[model samples]
Target: MLGIALLAHWLLGPPVVDFSHHSALSPIDMVATAHAEVKKPLTVNWQTLRELDYTTGKATPTVLNLLGTDTAVRVPGFMVPLDDSADAVTEFLLIPYAIACVHVPPPPPNQMIHVKMAGEKRQKVAWDPVWVQGRLQIVEMASPYGEAAYILTAVLVEPYTD
Candidate 1:
């Protein structure tokens, strides 16, 4: 039954998540974990972190926060491209807000996610918001802009909706 369910999930994305049960880890856990009053995130927004610039050594590059450590997470976010392509993007940056890199100063690294589409999830995707389901790691992964705090090997990438 577990195998069948996993297969089905890979082939077809599930419509909704049942957050009532806490016995299993769901995407909701990521949000709840972020809002926990007691525990604080590893990297605060104000902290100045030094990282290797994609092209050359820059004096300062804002370090993204790696929260949740190694945990299962599902989140809705906008896709930003590390490698620009017309269609069938295998890897990209998934940020918290739409048009994140558009403004003069980019959003803080803590708000960004590094995602790699795997398996059936590697289909053609638009630059629209997407709900990415997978494990989120709080590890620094290098990119052109800076480092992405969260790295997700997406099992499911579906169009996001309210």
Candidate 2:
């Protein structure tokens, strides 16, 4: 009887594990779970942004990958207010250096980012560095300060800690 049971088990390729106790997630729940999994934003730097060749208008594979995705990113830089408000601004240019596009000539388009606050959100202009978190789009924007190769739809703007 044991030999017969072993033969039958081998032929049947083992019994399937039962998972019926757990309820299947609905489509909406699955989507919510996926979004939650990707909620953490990616920290990006000037070096990664500089991978795009402004002169040739060619982006490296790494830069191209970020173009149209819903990927959230956090970039640390200095803000040059595009709006007239002195205290707060809805739009600004984020640069790698503080003095850039001010005393010195503007950096290449790839080095600058035109950041637009989401909805009616206004960020106070910070003389010190800041971290801008948002969805980054590769779109050319011409500003009074300089031309930016990328545009960031800012979700949050905070003072740089380190």
Candidate 3:
């Protein structure tokens, strides 16, 4: 019984788990690491974006507008491939979830970002964590679903590393 107790202590004691060490990262360190993961290049306010009915063949702008020319804003999001092929990235379904493309229908193209990588096509990293920086562009575009809607023009895309 004593030997079992000593073994348990050896495995689960302070020597194995040291939370009180001063060198341990503080809350501020974690916050800084998170901050480094995402950067806001440009933003369009919610009032400026014009929502259009994606279901209809005839494109009509909705009264519920959220983005415009002057209202700059930044939104954090993740990218999911529309197609099954990992390399054939014709379009990306942007969403708040790390794995939104698997089950979720995906955010509207306006809310979704169309990232155009600088220099070369952005390498595909883990899909879960990435920071997209770009300007919200209000323009008529046809989605892969054959619906026309406004889309955010993504200028840059980079993987978020901790």
Top candidate when judged by TM-score against the true structure? 2
Model 1 pairs in collision? none
Off by over 4 Å in 2: 1-37
Ranking by TM-score: 2, 1, 3
Query: Number of backbone collisions per candidate, in order?
Result: 0, 0, 10
lDDT of 3 at 149: 46
User: Per-residue CA lDDT of candidate 3, range 1-162, in tens?
Assistant: 333333344335534543335345576763454344323233433233324444542333432323444323344567666556686354564555565445446455444454444344544634566655544444555446322244544445556554
Provide the overall lDDT of each model, using Cα atoms, as 2-decimal numbers: 0.58, 0.82, 0.46
The collision pairs in model 2 are none
Q: Candidate 2 — what's its lDDT?
A: 0.82
Candidate ordering by lDDT (highest first): 2, 1, 3
Against the true structure, what is every candidate's RMSD? 12.9, 11.6, 15.2
Writing each residue's lDDT as its tens digit, candidate 1 over 27-72 gives: 5653464345223212222123224243343424233332344434
Lowest lDDT 10-residue stretch of candidate 3: 57-66
Give the range where candidate 2 is weakest over 10 consecutive residues by summed lDDT.
Answer: 14-23
